[model samples]
Target: SHFIVGLTGGIGSGKTTVANLFAEQGIDLIDADIVAREVVEPGSEGLAAIVEHFGEHVLQSDGQLDRSALRECIFSQPKQRLWLNECLHPLIRKRMLELIKQSTSAYAVLVVPLLFENGLDSLVDRTLVVDISPELQIKRTQDRDGVDKGQIENIIRSQMPRQQRLDKTDDIIDNQGEIQEIEQTVFALHKQYLSLSKAVLS
Candidate 1:
């Protein structure tokens, strides 16, 4: 089996920043969000199935999946959400596994925003949760995405409770500090994961 470390955080938790710092240390990143998008790109089976079930309105004029439209569709219909997940999760997981297999780093970082929600921890040897304050999460998400506070709060509500996520994580990276400090912590974790990977691989 491959040595995999899962990095997870809620929206606006700066997971990308922390992941980049590890990438700088030669770690490969298998980002679930990116894989999710890739699986639904134009002409993919995933997209075709989506269109078949949801109709063409889920796609933009250029034929790409209209993320906002799909989101709205699922948001208004819980059954649609479950159906879409059933349609897409297997494709996403298959692609993610392919990416992980291609990774040649000491250990790959499987960065997922819904690591716990999607039960992705089973794919990794260890899990890292990036923790941040709710107030900061709202502010950062609003600044980065131009999303309103109510929408951001809704996203937060949709995720596992902060404490529950923490209880399940093997490692916790605090994103409440300065970027310099966070980078330093990432470097430290990189070293730790490298050693841990060695132990596991040996």
Candidate 2:
């Protein structure tokens, strides 16, 4: 298997920004969010199952998943949310691994928001967590999404705690500062992973 780095962060952490840097370095990137959408595309089994379970209302007139509607649905209904996770998690994992297996880069970076929380870290060779303080996470998320402090706090509360995530990770990228500061750190990790992957191949 190719070396896989499981990259994750809390809601406000700069996971996407850091992942974009890796992509710019010609690294293969598989994002859980993208894979989630791909799995539920109009004609896919994932979408079919969702429609069967949640009904046609979850789909837009154009046949795409009404993401906002579905999000609202699951957010309010715990049983429905559990059902959805059970249905989608395996499908998402299968697709993500397939993409990783086919990757041509020296190694692949897999980005997932709830990587550790969902136990996805076991699937990757190395785990990279984008870290920031809870206060910073709250502030950044508030600024970027306009979410209220209480809601953001609930979200942070639901995920694996910051210290625990850091403990489990093989590497951490401090994203507490400005977004522009991540590029050099990303490049440094890129170089390390390249050599580490080569050593494995040799």
Cα TM-score of candidate 1: 0.94
Query: 53-121, model 1: which lDDT tens digit per residue?
Result: 989999999999999999988987989999999999889889989999999988999999999899878
Candidate 2 global CA lDDT score: 0.91
How many angstroms is residue 118 displaced in model 2 relative to the true structure, after the best TM-score fit? 1.2
**Runs in model 2 lying further than 4 Å from the true structure:** 68-77
TM-score of each: 0.94, 0.91
Model 2 residue pairs with clashes: none
Q: State the lDDT at 107 in candidate 1.
A: 92
Model 2 / residue 109 / CA error / Å? 0.6
Model 1 has an lDDT value of: 0.91
The deviation in Å at residue 102 for candidate 2 is 2.3
